[model samples]
Target chain A: MLYTFSEVLEKVNNEVKDLKFERKPYSLFEPIEYILEIGGKRVRPVLATMAYNLYKADIEKTIPIALAIEIFHNFTLLHDDLMDRADKRRGKPTVHIKWNDNTAVLSGDAMLIEAYREIAKSPKEALPEILNLFTDTATEICCGQQLDMEFEQRLNVTTDEYLEMIRLKTAVLLACSLKCGAMAANAPESDADALYDFGINIGLAFQLMDDLLDVYGDPATFGKRIGGDILCNKKTYLQITALKSPETGKEMQDWINKEVFDEQEKIDAVTGLYNKLNLKGLSEEMIESYYQKGLSCLNKVQVDDNRKRELRNLAESLLTRKS
Target chain B: MLYTFSEVLEKVNNEVKDLKFERKPYSLFEPIEYILEIGGKRVRPVLATMAYNLYKADIEKTIPIALAIEIFHNFTLLHDDLMDRADKRRGKPTVHIKWNDNTAVLSGDAMLIEAYREIAKSPKEALPEILNLFTDTATEICCGQQLDMEFEQRLNVTTDEYLEMIRLKTAVLLACSLKCGAMAANAPESDADALYDFGINIGLAFQLMDDLLDVYGDPATFGKRIGGDILCNKKTYLQITALKSPETGKEMQDWINKEVFDEQEKIDAVTGLYNKLNLKGLSEEMIESYYQKGLSCLNKVQVDDNRKRELRNLAESLLTRKS
Candidate 1:
């Protein structure tokens, strides 16, 4: 029996909520509970399940793998929140802000271990491949984060470098999710590889859309302050592309170099420069290219088109998200 | 042919040095290199190799397991240094101090993934069991560290609580090391269990000895300042025991509550109280009890006495260590 995307999401959420975290060490487990409770889209697990259902309708066996990806995602966010010194996550105070840095660090470490415990629960035959893939993904994600940090300290980050960073930091995990689900279902190597590629392209397009929305999305719908990237001088795709354009590059650089500019004014000037350079149109074209590439990869999978409708819908929903 | 202890250490060192870490992200790997270079005793890996040799002389097959435990040990230290906000490790600046806290956190995370990478390299037959053991040990260590941190903020930590924390934080990894090596060797489960128990007891004794030396040993030999633990008011077994005693508990409480007390005066007073209570003797007795338990566990292992000589010697060296 094929399940809809919402059904798959509900199953994943139930499994997550049912996890019996110990309550003795309130400092460690409390923050974990807080983060997991204030959930995201559960996109990774949903993707994993949707990929599995396309081959094997038995979602029971894939829940651990799904949970593993979810836990690992939260673990990374816990640390990323600390590294970014973020005050809020999903509209609540971050683990570090609510507790302290040490609590955040140690709790995050435990959560990483918890992620592995879930990964290990995969059927023995699939364990080695999944573990290897997960390890590589984990290492690449770290590299991606390091690159992101490195970029933050630099004034001139190339578009190429930024894309690679996001690919590592964001796309590989999505790819790993699909590939892992396929592996759990004992899908053929070719199909699994195709799903991975499909995920990577979709992930890239999804991130590109996120960059675009941060600037142009309506404030009431986006659930975040507009032009935050511009205010922080974050070297996102639009910023990098605008800075790379010869016509407006110098002016954009001058705006970025201003030491004591008002925050709102800086956001306005940068957004204005972005508009003048028509970066939004360029970014849309780039996103569409990746979206098409992703669809091609999905088409290459041997599964019938009908079986892929849920995954396709998910990709579309993510790309079109206003928040 | 079976290798001696130093030979095993040298083999592990060569394998570690031969590992080709990426240099592009110097911030992540550089701190890892720096910490590994300022080496500890490599006790965990050496114990692992010795346990493997006791059953199977093919040390070649165990190199990856050895390296895995060593890397995991170093990874813990990297984060532990940051959590404790310690300035120096082994007479050199910590990763956080040398690079920064974020560097320490991310690099430690990468090293942990690297440890799993090494563990995955274990012979296929031993991989799952070793991974399960490693994961459990890793989680327990985190729990232990959390307990330690929690205890730091409280004044009424019990001796049993302190023992359990140290066992989790310190002993379990040692036990895991020996048990993993035995599993790799396909040693009898009974013998493997005995070796694990032996490691736990030895590890407890080792930590107890460390606490004793921190108060009584010569600074030159200890490689750290005497009375430093007392100065920081760390709730070691010594402090916990003294605080629990009816005869001196009141005086100990008063001394601990002194907000602006002179550091030297506090240290002198604490040392005087410990001497009055003969805590040094009580601690030595506790160490001997654990050491004896460890030896008894070793005796229970089915391996020939000659096959056990190196492990016995290593245990003795650790027990008698001044630093």
Candidate 2:
């Protein structure tokens, strides 16, 4: 019942799947390949194919579009790694760390241009609409990133504000992926719009769950340490919601204001307080609400129940992921 | 003839011009706008258009193609400034210097993506060949830049070796612009091939003149201090040719072997030696030879005398520039 239906999407993914770097004279290609092969979940492309699958029988027709989304996503990560001065991503050396900032910057630029090349090759019939949607979504993502960067500097960022930022930066691309897929499959316009909304709600839920996992999940399951977000003082839903809470708000701020006791200690104490105040349960409830919204949007689509069931099951599987 | 016949080239350059950076959030766009507004001669676009015009009358319709070339050129410059730690370009501060490296990098990526967007928008008639040419040219430009960076480290770069390096680093894009324009115009394959060769030879000549002017041109016309290349110990044609000449060869090698020298004294002494060996005269002869070769290539293109003559006049004008 899982959507193994997108064999073409799988082929497209595999076409680019870990293609060899094939080093050139004075090559900048290798480090970029290193970063790309470091093993991401390939979420954007998957979403694109899944979304497209809901609308059309010919999923392979949208492979180039899916490739565009994947490449664009990778380009962002390459540049972001440089800005973050991050040393590792997915247990492999960051491009900038492995090569240098200059290589990372230029290779990332090349990768981005490559994404456009992929878009340009899409079936001409769907070109204009898909290009517009992709461009618009890319812009929104950039805006989201800017806010995320700005958030690190602000002394005040409300939970609602963080939600808006993530919705722009991360959710829109996910939504656009589905919309693009639908457009490619020549699905009814109404169905495409509904699918877009559904993807957005699912995306929002996914990010909120990510926020929850940072605080409460086990390290072995998450593949990264839990409470790492608190150590970095990131403005997540748990922290922002806890800060705005009436009962223990000021004390939490006081604890945050401290020249941060031990990093792990700060994370553990705050996480413990989140448990005491039932913040985790509250975040979980909010996540569930969004999931329901997603399911409702899914129900609004006119697809057969079996296919619809598969999609719902897929979304559920996403939520059930331990990592 | 118009003194700068390159205008014919400029007018036709757009056939292959790809512009329109993929939109990023408004926050990342400010620096891109700031950088693009700083003026340049846009010589590469002109060369592309001019070379392309020689083959087809409909070249004007290829504006998107030319825009692509211009945007990609600027994209490289933006990233190069960051790598060079350069603070200014065309009398304005660089993107990275004006904003921050993060912004410059992200914006530059956006700009590169935009170049492809413009390419993708090419009239369907002009797409397949245009994209292939653009991709090959763009990749070559990257390879050239990598070589330029690599040259900074090696000590024994010879005359032939240095020619090959600059031919790639500076001249290939100019040549590519011309070739791309030809592709856009859907000129006879024969014309495209000849113009490509002419562009390559003309580029070699133009770069030689630039190297010559760097040491010997009048200050008012040249816009920057002459001999800056010599001061930086850049391996240029003059040094290479002088080192290859029997009389001055060993002395030139000795001069280059020293890691540091007084700037004014070194410039004056080197210029004196180059004159004594008649190295500038040799360089002028070689430049003329390539120019002649370029003219011969232009002769092979079956075009109207008026248009061909205009391109010829443009090449001649470049030879005479004091700058």
Candidate 3:
């Protein structure tokens, strides 16, 4: 399973690495290359390939769709950095930070178009379905981004709203990857839809765990600072769910409404309260429930038992991991 | 000529206003309507219709193609505003400023895809050809945008370099508009290619005139501040060509190097120097030269002389515009 995942990651990195030349002899391309090169876990593309392999082991055929997924993912990261005003991505300077906002936007635009071009490379008969899925996925991701922006200034947002936002913003693209890969491999529509469900469920679980880890995980091993979301006052799943907790709702609102506080003190207070509320455990349980549902979706697909076993095992490995 | 131009503008505006809602929710549709309402001249799309009218008078058939051009144009503007950190576009706040950077980028992304879908609406015989031209135009627009960015800080650019940049940035899409229109109307390939040259030349001429008007036009008529390019230190044709003159080179460099000056005073001084070097007249002469070349291209097309007269009259009208 590790080798299979690595195989998909390799192609994703390759496609993302060989972006168009940095025309005009400037270092603007550096930040773009920087964010893409600094490395992600390649989870989306891996799900695409693994999902395809669940029905058919055509790794070669699935590579391009996986590559498309990865490109689209990175493209989002580029623009999201601007929205987040994030200076660093993956421990490296972001596209907008390193280059001016203009270059960042242009390069991101180019990357997105390239993603579609890559997706359109599938065989003619296979293309319309995959293209339709890719188009729908892109729009869903946009809607997710819009919702994420809406979450920022809207204090009335509920946990369900946050969940939907994350699903659109993060999960749908991951699902599209799997769906595209299966469609490319000529899987039946039912199997492709099942794969989509499986990927989207995992993606939701993955984001849920991310919200948990941001507050509860060991910073050294987590590859991010504990409570980074609290530091930024980002509207994440844990924050929303914790705020939505009937008993804690009023107090949490008071904390969030405070305009001025010591930075570290705010982080400390938020982290302490989140832990006291058992939100981490709640997150863990909910994430596992989604994973179980995802596994059931996989099992329901009409594929060979061995293939199903491999997929079920892979999902377990991802869901149960700490890092 | 004015009647034809107004007729085209009105029809394009009406057709563009008539977008069918394939997706739910009005907010998703707002950006497109917002941009169209900002009231551009519909220059590219009109060029498309005019070019098609040259070979075939059934110009109604090209509406989808023309709308595709408009969509692509707005997509560029949306993303460009994000890149430029521009606050207002045509007296309204930019998409990024009004909504958020993520919405701007995503809306722009969706606009580009929708443009492709619209382009794909041509007859099947024209579909592949239009896609090819659209893709090529899309690539050129990116390259052109990259060059425009490159020109910002670049000091050694000559008139030829500036022309090349504008040709790609402003002209290619215009050329693509005409070419796509011709293809959609099933005009002869030679007529399409010739019309492409005409549109490209005319587009370049129009951008040059815009540069001229930026410094010289009445604020009310121009709908914005005069000398905006000078204020921004834009390396436009006037500035670049003025700098290219051996005598004005030193004076141009001085003004450019000046870190501080009163806005009106600085604009006056630069305008004075450009006048002294006759850069405006030079630009005027160059514009006329291209207009002639455009007309010459129009002449070479094998279409009936009477039908060709419509495009030629439009060119003449654009040549004589005051604002």
Candidate 4:
């Protein structure tokens, strides 16, 4: 009765599509519907659902929590896009651009509320725990985002600091999503903790892979300009490592301090320095370490290895994903 | 053993003061502490505590819910000030003015998560109902704000439409505050419903009085400058009524459409037209009606009259206060 990755993904998509934003104050609800409709991979909710499928066959009971995670993820994206002043998300105009800043702020707030309402629909016995976990995860994400913003202004950010920031900003919700699903299935507490740990490692690896793909992936497959992070001087793991290395630190700083430069030249220069440092090999090593650590945690779960197949495949796919 | 209104207010204030924002990423939490520190009347929490006091002697048990309401209210104000492009709140610089818009948005979001975290600390039996009530109320407030913003660009907003907007934007939180306290106290559902009704009516009256005072209160007592709303062409209850009136509609439109004029002259002319139309009297009647309706609902609560005294006093003070 275990749902495969695509099956869980389909289930999550169906639930999101079924949500009606037909409330009054169409301005507030329309953006929510718009963002939800212009969907991404549904990664968070699918993670939640697949995690649930690891322990229980009653996938129907997990839909609300799954949708909650998805909606919450979208809420964060909506606000983050506004904060970053980015013009697009998933290749479509962001809410602030589509409507206005006020609409983005208000609708984003409502979406957070909507996420909580969905979480509250959990079985009464599990509501309190799920609610607490979700809130704590949410708070961490905010702090993570704050740190990410703060790091943007500084040049001395360490690799550890960057990892911690991504952990808070990105990984914890992934952890929470997995743990919530396990909890909903009445999984043993130890098993749930194991799943949470699995999520954290995989999430860290997942984000690292994103950073890696931004620099190394083919443009036709990456779905974005490959040198975006480089052109913007984003302090990803590779950049942080390159900046910390004595061999490349001086040159990296010179490049970052440039008032203006040709975009391709800067990208090429940074890419060349990263190559000299063998940053690609190092980042891959880090990614592989976390990916293996995630597998170890998954191995500790009390569930049979067969039941863990889809989740295993997901982690593998994420590590190897080109886009 | 029921706590007095002042006692509850003191408790709520003390709890707010004691909340530590010492977590990492001080930039994210500092603004949260800053907004909470500047403070307000603590109305929502006080209402919650007093409502709890009516049914139980254990006011300590209600502190988490009370603080939750207070923090949530401040969070809304933080974002609202940003959206309104407001420079000041309560005679002090707002969070956005003090920090930045991104800070305001992120910190406001964090405050919301903080509120839910506090609410989760409520007695487990009451958590579900309170969380649902809170989520619903939060969504309504967002809708209310959206409508308020939408109404700004239109010239034909009806009295009912305006009332509905205020009810959603301003009144529901008040209602939710009272009901949450009652729920925490394990009040009977019927009694809780009555308290909610009382909150709604009084909240409507409270907002109406704010609109009235903006136009008619003594400058010495109103704290804020009178006719500021008029100067900005804010669509308050008085302006909406004036717009709907045959006697004053044309002149009001003339004044509203003028692109250039003295601020005081515009205020005076608007005040004169309001006087000629008796908007002051009409607004007062509307406030009085809501106040009476509130009292009637309070009367339906099964609590002894003696236990209702502080709440009754608070409501009366709200109706009569100039500022």
TM-scores, each model vs. reference: 0.97, 0.86, 0.88, 0.99
Report the lDDT tens digits of candidate 2 across residue range B1-323. 22234445445333323323344446677666666667576676676666666655565555666677788888889998898788888778898888888888777766775676666666666676677678767766776677677766765567687777677767777777777777777778888888888888988899899898898899888988888877776778787677678888787777767777787888898888789977788889989998999999989887776777767776788888887
Q: Rank the candidates by DockQ, best first.
A: 4, 1, 3, 2
| Candidate number with greatest TM-score | 4
In candidate 1, stretches whose alpha carbon ends up further than 4 angstroms from where it belongs are A259-262, B259-264
Better model by TM-score: candidate 1 vs candidate 3: 1
Ranking by TM-score: 4, 1, 3, 2
Better of 1 and 2 by lDDT: 1
Evaluation by TM-score, superior candidate among 1 and 4: 4
Off by over 4 Å in 4: none
Among all candidates shown, the one with the greatest DockQ: 4
What are the per-residue Cα lDDT tens digits for candidate 1 across B205-255?
999998999999977888888899988888898888788888878888888
- Top candidate on lDDT is 4
Candidate 3 lDDT, tens digit per residue, B194-243? 98999899988988988899997878777778998898888788898778
Candidate 3 residue pairs in clash (backbone atoms < 3 Å): none
lDDT of 4 by residue, B146-240 (tens): 89888889889999999999999899999999999999999999999999999999999999999889989999989898999998788898888
Q: List the residue pairs that clash in candidate 4.
A: none
Query: List-wise, what DockQ does each model earn?
Result: 0.77, 0.33, 0.36, 0.91
